[model samples]
Target: MAEKITIFAHVRNICKASIFRICPPCLAALSRILARFHSNTQRQLVLFLNTAHFLTIGVSLALVVAFFLYAVDGRPIKGEDSFASEESEEFLPNVREIVGEIRPGDSLSSSFRSNGVDEEVRESVISAFDGVMNFREMKPNDRYTLTLDNDGTLIKCLYESGPLEVHAIERTPEGSLAAKKLDVALDCRTVKLRGRIESSLFAALAAFKEDAKLVYTFADIFASKIDFNTETRFGDTFELVVEKYYKNNEFVGYGKILVARYNSKEVGPLEGFYFDQGGKSAYFDHRGYELGESFIRSPVPMARVSSGFSYNRRHPVLDIVRPHLGVDLAAPMGTPIMATSDGRVRFAGWKGGYGKQIILDHGGGYQTYYGHLSRFAN
Candidate 1:
């Protein structure tokens, strides 16, 4: 009687185990097979493995069901990728594009709210794109577009303030926002420009009815040869064959300066031609010597020099003669000061007479110092 009771228990356990994996008919068939096993070791081992295999099959089938439910919706899971990425595709179809420019008292959030966009979606776009673009950098008259689908759901956005600052933001089918920077379309033409400096190189470029961009390009070409800020005379002359960029018939900026000629009385006449061989592009002098300035001449190109770098110099404020290692620049208080060279900051903050200063270590014993700064750039 005890052995018969044990057989019934084994049969009941087998039926319960395979219930989910098999139908009721299959369970009954399995139960009839288990009733013949008794306590036979071979039959008992076979039944144990058979049930274990069905259990694995059960787990697999459950996973397949879950996969089918989600596979119908074709999208990467939310955590699978980041919010924004650089994309090459420029346009999307079946959408109505609403274009607008940023107004004086407008924000991205307020603009979206006025357009009836969902608050949750607007916040997601802001959060996703905040790292790519700063709210403070969004100036008045910056252009933006909203591409809505047939259902009036926002599918894409394009925003631009400058030639190189076009941002394309799009929403995926998964309701995730994707962002990318689009390249600007510009017409490049090699043009010749001739100008004479009346006050400074910057002023000369402005007087020529050209963008201030040409000043930097021309300066960069002859940076090592001449200091346009200090050495430039009123009669200094310049001629250049350069590439200028234009978008929609409006001047955007300047590109590569192919040929440059400068005749300054202090530095004499100097010429440089752009040469690109094998993938390296560089400026070459008339004698074919590569030209590049390792050091910038001035810390402030626009500011006038209040005092020169000197030894045994008379201090204006202290009324005492002392060694003044760094030059003094005359600029308005809180004016931005840029680094003359690239380096890691070895020191930043106050240093007594220097006030707020920054010391940059440019690898080798080459260290540059910026003194009396109003604030540090982030």
Candidate 2:
């Protein structure tokens, strides 16, 4: 019995050693299979949730698009249908404005015809301006404005001939046009202009932005005392109290020189004040002396004395030394020569050496001779 027990115990010990060695690899294989199964299961669960969430978002976007299209197609835009329904609505008379300057060789009739005015309307307009304006004297560059209806019916016409004058024509109630000349009501503002003679009176005034017309008027105001042509010195200064006209805050023109003061280096300080007395306007000095002399020193305004009165002088064309009795005033060839003083024409023909001359005899012993004239005044 002892030997049998020994053999059984030895077999049992051998079987226990084999089980311990094999159990290690079998347990490791089982753990790897369980880990792989858990990884695949988690991956499938994440994919399913992501696909379901995308499907839900895509369905919501499609529904929102469908709702937008359905809402826009349900109603029509406002004001689109009202335009055709109100076809017979009376609007304010459609006014068309035409503004332009008169071109060269343009007549009033031609201007009206070219601007789509009817024949009868043109004739009516011409008749309207018959006593008001001289249609024949319409000059180029004259600005005009015509107001008309949409059907080319004339409403109002305005012709601005000068800065201060306007000719207006309006359609009357009797279907005829009536014309009237309107002097633009000017707001006279007293302005003082001071300048020193640099080169010329015109240049000095022009530097001050004075109008050319104002310059001529200023020279005329002081014509008796100051010779604007050759007597203006470099340091000569002048102050003018002038009446400048304005319309709608825009300078229109000049009215008159109220007072003028001129200080010359050649001549002394001369002053003139305009005054209205005895139903006539005249300029007077500070001492109330009348500046208007019976005879103007120069026959032509702003003309220079080319040759003064002398016993011996050389002729320009003749090239001969002779006696020059009268002052030779230099002017343009076709310049209009006015009588220096109120006198009768003594001789109005060509003289010996003078080309074309006019001899005016005053009632007194003074006789004025105007030589090198183009023609005699009527």
Candidate 3:
């Protein structure tokens, strides 16, 4: 009875909505029939709405899931992935070969042959290097390195001659070559050294661990007039400007002595000048006089001033006191002595008490003689 009553109430609510309106008896009978149909239509409408909403939500969720999986699997969309991959491939470097350093004294042909480089390639690289570096001037033990690209074009060529000078050659975009000069910037240094007369000039300057080559060069420049060993006073001072090479903030090596001033105790201020004149480089004095004179004084390079000029000196072999005419440069028996002045070979034979001697008559009464020579110079 309760179920029948609830169904009748639901039918009254559905039919009252103007779907049916008629007389009392007829309306009452039709109302029961229409109520039954209206109740059945309500149930079907509720089921259809729930099924349609479920299908819409399920299809939306599946589309979202499929998009996530496709992104993760790296599928190409609009072919963007393939185009990106091809772009990366274009930038990859194509290495042709690896070559080692070309040491000095290595012929171009031999060096390239060892590195598996062809003759034509070697000739091209050599031609490029010649424009910047003089290959003939290369010394033994100098360093050189080479590299190539995919098209057999030289990529990089590095050459190191000294601590300061380096040559770098690289290819340009126009398929030509370019050169860069990388000279280690020189560090200027001014130092003052003073000492008493010692065993040798090098020994006196030993307090400063200077470049021996530079010191020797300095001595040679002033060897003609100033005698560092004999003529140097006890309080003589030397001021010099030495060029040093510093790499990565550490001292590596030295260049030429750019400027040097030696105030000799006896002689006045002696200065050395290095200048480039008419595209040629040379050393000279402030007066433009070339530092290279006609002749260097001492034949033997600064071993020592063994003996000085004297009127009476006992001979070692003769064991008798005699007037030594010229300065006795006591060196090893085999040491070659040079001619102090440039003159014709007026005398190059044996003389009394002067064994195997050479006498160069420099005109006037001033003639230089080198005695006890192992071999006469040509």
Best by lDDT: 1
In the range 152-207, model 3's lDDT, one tens digit per residue, is 76788777876666988888888787887786665654444444444456656676
Q: After superposition, how far is residue 320 of candidate 3 from its true place, in Å?
A: 13
Q: What is the C-alpha lDDT of each candidate?
A: 0.76, 0.75, 0.67
Instruction: At residue 329, give the lDDT of candidate 1.
Output: 87
What's the CA RMSD for each of the models? 21.2, 19.1, 11.9
Better of 1 and 3 by TM-score: 1
lDDT of 2 by residue, 221-263 (tens): 6677867777788989989999888988898887779998889
Evaluated against the true structure, the overall lDDT of model 1 is 0.76
- Cα misplacement distance, residue 347 of candidate 3 (Å): 14
Pick by TM-score: 1 or 2, better one: 2
TM-score of each: 0.62, 0.66, 0.53
| Candidates arranged by lDDT, highest first | 1, 2, 3
Per candidate, the number of residue pairs that clash is: 0, 0, 1
Better of 2 and 3 by lDDT: 2
True lDDT of residue 185, candidate 3: 69
User: Of the candidates numbered 1 and 3, which has the greater lDDT value?
Assistant: 1
Ranking by TM-score: 2, 1, 3
lDDT of 1 by residue, 1-378 (tens): 566555545655655565444566765565556556555853675577567868877898999888877755655445433233112223334667676777788898877677676776577668767778778888888887777776776677788877778988887788888887777888998999888888888887787688765666677767667766689898989899989889898887778889999998998998999989999899999898987656666655556788888999998889999899988889778656656667899999999988988999988889988888888888
- By summed lDDT, the worst window of 10 consecutive residues in model 1 runs over 82-91
